[model samples]
Target: MPFALYLLALAVFVMGTSEFMLAGLLPAIAADLEVTVGTAGLLTSAFAAGMVVGAPATAAFARRWPPRLTLVACLFVFAGCHVAGALTPAFPILLATRVVAALANAGFLAVALSTATALVPPGRKGRALAVVLSGTTIATVAGVPAGALLGTGLGWRATFWAVALLCVPAAFGISRRPAGADDGSAPDLADEVRQLGSPRLVLALLLAALVNGGTFAAFTFLAPVATGVAGLGEAWIAVVLVLFGAGSFLGVVIAGRLSDRRPGLVIGVGGPLLAAGWSALALTAAHPAVFLTLALTQGGLSFAVGSTLITRVLYAATGAPTMGGAYATAALNAGAAAGPALAAAVLATGAGVTAPVWVAVALTAAALAVKFAPWWTGSRRPDPIKRPRL
Candidate 1:
């Protein structure tokens, strides 16, 4: 892989951290801002909704611009939003800043995936995308946990400041990177609409929502889950997050390799593991050992489900890589928003503590049952020789 690709990975890592760090800092934010915990949680919802809108909207607007340039602008916007978030005095101002930052994050991810695929050989595109996208997985291991610790030790504003500082150079690095190939033109609004119209693409995206929605529903509120339901406490949340990320990394690496070897097989295992992991998660607060065990198990299963889902969408989308794949990114953020929103609903009844794990169990089951009827005519040979990319 080109060194520029590693730069892409770094940018992704920072953005993922920026988007997710709020969760770790929610308690601090609630205390400092003097808001109810549920209201403070809207920050998460706002950012996620921004991504859901920004992914498609930005992709449409930037269709005529160079992908690299688009990515840089998005990164710059992301960094600036962090600064705004840090400086904002009122809760509403902070919420607004988070939304803008999330929009930038959505645009950045869509553009990054588009650029990564274009930068590689046709045969290795999947692997290239994996290499660059691994930053997200790495975030769980490093970014989210670190952000949690930073928020607890420094303050929520300090967390945003740190994210801003990290993103400044990432924007510069993106600007310096080489352009993606000119073989395929950037996708326009019409192209994106057409791609969304496809049944296959629809199923792929539905698969993303069904699987990821539940995962996020459970995991997005994880900090609270750890402390509230599991009775762990804020002092230890970061360390446990690191452990969750560790298991997640294992799943990502393994799934990437499996996609290269056999995409179909990966999907089959995805549904089963997703269910198993979340089932374990639902039982997490049942016991101390069970809580820790579920954290690791859910981490692995979620990654396996996510990686395979991305791979499946990319392989099936074929010609409309930018459009179809970008929608998947949108699904990801939308799913994130959905999970927490559902959690909030449960919290209103003072049932919030148990909401996440159970919601995750339901969503994972839905994901497993998403039954993509045999669309494949078994036309393509399952040749290990023409390996899927890294």
Candidate 2:
């Protein structure tokens, strides 16, 4: 892999930390801003909304800009948002900063995905994408935990400051790269937008959404499930989370090696196993040892399937190289939003915390059914890599 790819991953690590660290800081933010915890939670929703909108909007608006310039500008804006957020006293202002920061994060990811693939040969696109996405998994493993510790030791504002400082080095690294690193010409915006109407591409995006939605459905509520259902102590919560993150990092690495050659086999084998793991988790939630082991297994299978589905989306949207990343980003965020919301609804029904695990199982099963439907495998189906002209 190219050295620039590592730099891009570094930037992603900062952004991913900012995005997820809020989960551990909501209480401090709520108390500081004189708001209920539920109200402070809106900050997360705002960020996700921004990501869903920003990925395509920013990517389209900056399509004509130099790739390096777009990346650097997004990083500066992201860092600035953190600075402003750290200084703000009002909850509304902090919420606004989260939205703006997410927008910048989305733009950087959109451009970086295409740029990463551009740095490698066609056959290595999946591996390149995995290298870029590994930053996110690593963020889950290390950055988020460190952010939580920092927030606990200092104030939550300090976490924001730390993220901003981290962005400076990433911005400098990205800026030092030559402008010609991205070899592709700017895509035609009209053609790119039109490709959204492609059935094959749409299906691929849906698959990506389903895979991530299922994963987040369980992940967002893991803490409650571990304590209330599994009878684990508070300290064990972090341990299980770390184990899951470690599994996720391993999953992405394995997908990188296999996805380029056998995407079908990866998804086909991984999807069912992921669903089965979720089912087992729900059934055995009362057993702490079993629950902990299943958490790690599910994490690996979930990311393995999710990563492969994302690779498929890239191939399905081959006609729109620039917009392909935007579409994938949008789909993944949409799933992330929808999954947790649905799980919350299920909990509202007094179905217990384990209900979310069942929701994950259903979602994964639906993805498999959609993926292997007769129509999807029919003779009329087009090759994922060969997008027909719109």
The reply for model 2, stretches above 4 Å from the true place, is 179-184, 379-390
* Top lDDT prediction, candidate number: 2
TM per prediction: 0.88, 0.97
Which pairs clash in the backbone of model 1? 127-390, 217-339
Clashing pairs in model 2, backbone N/Cα/C closer than 3 A: none
TM-score of 1: 0.88
Error of 2 at 315 (Å): 1.3
lDDT of 2 at 301: 89
Residues 256-331 of candidate 2 have per-residue lDDT tens digits of 8888788877888898899999999999999999999988888888888888778777777778888888998999
Q: Write the per-residue lDDT of candidate 1 for residues 242-294, one digit (tens) a residue.
A: 76777777777777676645766766766777777666666657565777777
